[model samples]
Target: MSTRTPLDVFLSDQALAEAREQAKIPGTLAIAITPAAPGTQCSWCDCDIALNETEHRCKGCPNPAAVIMHQFRHGSPVRVDVPLCTGCHPDAARFVLALAQAGGTR
Candidate 1:
């Protein structure tokens, strides 16, 4: 369990810088924060979740309710937002583009 409250956390300067650098092409990077601490990875996708969003959600999430609706849906643990350094991945472009179209940033 995390002791920090939602309001107690904000993007750190170092993290923001790192995210910016990894983001490449300004404005394409947005953090998917969660209420829990960092270092936890998604059980289903094996993605590391960054604790940045209020609900800890990431972009391009295929099933918004998959993680929230049930703890162990269909025998597989729900996958929540995971910390990702995937800016250079093949699908990163599409994901970033989508966020951009959605008005990046919460």
Candidate 2:
């Protein structure tokens, strides 16, 4: 069993909300963000290239040109967001568009 303290057990919702809000404010606290290792590959096509903020290619063909979020609903709603390379992004977009038009989800 885990030991619990009164301070931990009695955390208020407002306190939690305030803490979350503070975390979003830049320079509220000092924190270091580590960059990805050199030779990091694009998430979509596994191309060994420098990636931008979204972990996709920064340049060249087959690079990620777009990031898309797809919402799926079967019984419960689900969301999927991914970066796609230029070659695959168009096809994926078309498929998602078609699915939305058909009012279907999987």
Candidate 3:
């Protein structure tokens, strides 16, 4: 029996839930980071990052709040690293690199 835990998910920074879920890969996450100091919930698994835990983020795309407060105001896309826990960061980064190597954005 496979029991899934909260730590076993990964979400992308796509602007919409549909886009986020298009990957539809098992063992991934899709929750928004909210209600914490600068968004505390992990972007991938939505797990609360303990004070002692390490966190990481990937290159971010424009989201509404960020567009209004940052990229738009800055006249360019701002650096937006969606908060992710250490556990999820490596796989997400590897996937991104793989995509870049593919030479065509899907």
| Residue 2 lDDT, candidate 3, scale 0-100 | 34
lDDT against true structure, model 2:
0.40
> Model 1 segments beyond 4 Å from truth?
1-15, 18-81, 84-89, 104-106
Candidate 3 at residue 38, lDDT? Answer: 32
Clashes of each: 10, 0, 4
Question: What is the C-alpha lDDT profile of model 2 across 35-100, one tens digit per residue?
Answer: 222333224443455545475543433443333323323333233434454466566567656765
RMSD of 3: 16.5
Model 2 TM-score, 2 decimals: 0.31
TM-score of each: 0.22, 0.31, 0.30
Residues 1-106, candidate 1: write the lDDT tens digits: 3455545455443444454454454434434333334433323332466656457544443322211111111222232243323332324436645765796432
lDDT of 3: 0.35
The superposed Cα distance between candidate 3 and the true structure at residue 92, in angstroms, equals: 0.9
Ranking by lDDT: 2, 1, 3
Q: Which candidate number would show the highest TM-score if scored against the true structure?
A: 2
Pairs clashing in candidate 3?
9-28, 9-29, 10-28, 10-29
Candidate 1 clashes between residue pairs 3 or more apart in a chain or in different chains: 33-52, 33-53, 33-56, 34-52, 34-56, 48-82, 48-83, 49-82, 49-83, 50-83
Please report, as a residue range, the 10-residue window in candidate 1 with the lowest summed lDDT: 65-74
On lDDT, the leading prediction is: 2
Sort the candidates on TM-score, descending order.
Answer: 2, 3, 1
